[model samples]
Target: MAVAWYRARLVESRPQTPTARTLVLRAPGWPGHLPGQHVDVRLTADDGYQAVRSYSLAAPTDGDRIELGVQSVPDGEVSPYLAEDLPAGAEVEVRGPLGNWFVWRPGGTDPVLLVAGGAGIVPLTAMVRARGEAGSPAPFHLLYSVRGPDSLWYRDHLAEDTPGLDVRIVYTRTAPPGTSRPPGRVTAADIPGVPAGRVYVCGPTDFVEAVDDLLIDLGRDPATIRTERFG
Candidate 1:
C-alpha cells in the first residue's frame, strides 16, 4: 500500500547556518514519528513539474507540528528552495514519518552514543530532543563534525550544559580560537573510550564508514552499532 501524502503548511522557518534552515510544518493528521525517521517533501512547479526529496526529522512531532532540518545543496532542484526560499504558510505535500531501523526509542537505561557529520546531525538532533522530552534516563554523547563553526547547527541548544548529555564538536577546516583539537577530520581520539549500550552513526558515507571501523577497532561490538549514512 502507498503511504498517503498530506498537505503540510509551513509554520515557521529559522536559519541553522548560512545555508541550512530549520522548517516547522503544521501537517494536520500527521501520525507522530520516531526520532530518527524522515519525511519526503514534494514540491510542484507552476508548469506541473514536481520534485521530491527526503529530509531528516529534526524533532519528534508536537501535536500537528513536525520539523525538518535542511542543508542547501548548491544548484540542486529541491534543497535550495527548502533551505532558502520557502515562506510561511506555503503548502507542500509531505509523506511519512518513515523508516524504522534507525529509530531510537525511550526506555533504555544504557548510554547512547550519537555520531553526526554535517547535515547528518538533523536526525540525531531529533533523538536528543526525544530523549529530553520523554524524560528517559539514558545518557547520550553526541560527536558532531562539520567544516567549521559557521556550519554548525542547533548551536544554542548544543552549547548548553545539559545533564546526562555530552556534546563534542569537531571542525574539519577551521577552528575557533583556543579550541584544543586542531582542525581536521574526526579521528579515533574523538570517539569515546567507554562503550555505549547503543551506538548510532549518521554522516556522509565515508565518515560513517570511518567511525564504524574505529568503533570496531576499539572493541565495540558490531551488533551494538547502528548507522545511517548519506552523501
Candidate 2:
C-alpha cells in the first residue's frame, strides 16, 4: 500500500503512565487506520537536521483522533521531543498506517493472548479496546509487564470492571511493598495458565525473544505466535 503523509495537529497530550504519554492528533483528511498500525513522524531541528520515528496508534480503529503512547527513553531522539516538547496545536508530519500482516482486528473466533513489555503495550491496547467495543466473540488475555506499578499504562482501563477481557500485570523491577515475589524481570513462571490459540508479543528485542522461547516451551504452536520487536 502507498504511504501518504498527513499534516496532523496535536489535539491533546497527556500522561498515560509514569514514563509514557498519550498524544492525540487530528488529521483532517487522514484515512482511518487499523488497530495495530503505526505512523512514522518526522521532526526537524533548528539547524535543518531531522529525525524520524515510528509510533503505534493507541486508540481504537474507529476513533476520530489518533493516539500514540510514547515512553520517555533517556536521550532518545523522538521520544523526548514528543514527551516534553510537543504540545497541543503543534503541527507535525507523519506517514502511514503501514504494515500488512501484523494488523489485528476484533472479529476472530479463536482466543488471543497479548503479551506486552514496557511501552510495547500501545498497539495491543488498541486491539483490546476494539475488541471490547465490538463485543467480539474472541476471548482476550493480556500479560503486561512493566518496571513498577507506577509505570503500568492504562491502569484504570484494565480494571476488572472492564468487560470482556482478562488482564494480568507483572512488575519486573519493583513490586508493591509487602509483595512476596522478588522484584525482577518477567520469567516463564509468571505467564498465566490460559489455553493459547493465537498469541501476539511486543517489546524490546530481548524481551520478545525471551517470551517467545517461553511460549514455545509451554506447548504453544510456533506458527500461531506473532511478534513485534522494538529497541
Candidate 3:
C-alpha cells in the first residue's frame, strides 16, 4: 500500500537546546502513528529545490496532530530551519508512520529498557509518553547519554518523579558538581544486567554499537535488543 503525503501546518515550535527543537504539526486526516515511528519531512524552496529528512515522532499522535524533535546537523539542509527558524503555520509535507521494528505498542506489562545517546531521546520520549497515555504498567528504565547538562532534552519532564519510570543521565563530557559518576562514555556499569524484556537503543552509529555490545556482554539476549542508529 502506498502511503500518501499530507500537508501539515506547524502548530508550535519549542527549543530543547541551542541546536535542537521540538515541532508540533497539525496534519488533517492523519492516520495516528505508533510510538517510535518516524516521518519524512519535505521542504521545498522557492526555486523548486526540495530536501527531505527523517525525524522520529516525539509523541504519540493526537487526532490530527503529531510531534517531532529535530537536532540540527552542523551543515545540513533541513534541520537548521526546523530546529531554529521554522515558524508556526508554515506548511510542510509529511509521509510516514515509518519503521515497524522499533515501535513500542501500548498494553504490555513487560519491562522496557531504553538507551538513548544525544538526540536519540526523541523516539524514546514517545515511548515514555505512550506508556503514560495508555496507562501501561510497564516498568521503564531510561539510560540517556549526552555531552553535559546543557545539552540534555526533556530536562524538566524527566526530572519529575513519575511512577514506574526511572531515568538516569550520563554525561560524557562534563559531570555536574559533586556527582559520583565521572565524565566518560557509557560503560558496562551504566547498563542494567540482562534486561528481561525489550531493550531499545538509539543513537549515533558508534554509540548504538557500543551499547549493543555492552548489553550482550551483560548477558542480555541480543535478539531482545532493537537498535536504530543515525549519523
Q: Once superposed on the true structure, which residue ranges of model 3 sit more than 4 Å away at CA? A: none
TM-score versus the correct structure, for each prediction: 0.97, 0.93, 0.98
Q: Can you write out model 3's per-residue Cα lDDT over 129-162, one digit (the tens) per residue?
A: 9998888999999999999988999887788788
Clashes of each: 0, 0, 0
- Highest lDDT, which number? 3
The residue-by-residue lDDT of candidate 1 on 1-231, one tens digit each, is 678799999999999999999999999999798899999999999999999999999997688899999989988999999888898899999999789999999888789999999999999999999998888889999999999999999998798778899999999999999999999998899987655598999988999999999999988999999999987
Ranking by TM-score: 3, 1, 2
Q: Which residue pairs overlap in candidate 2's backbone?
A: none
Q: Which whole-number lDDT from 0 to 100 does residue 114 have in model 1?
A: 94
Which regions of candidate 2 are displaced past 4 Å? 178-180
Candidate 2 structure, TM-score to reference:
0.93
Query: What TM value does model 3 have?
Result: 0.98
Which scores greater on TM-score, model 1 or model 2? 1
To one decimal, what is the Cα RMSD in angstroms of model 2 from the true structure? Answer: 1.7
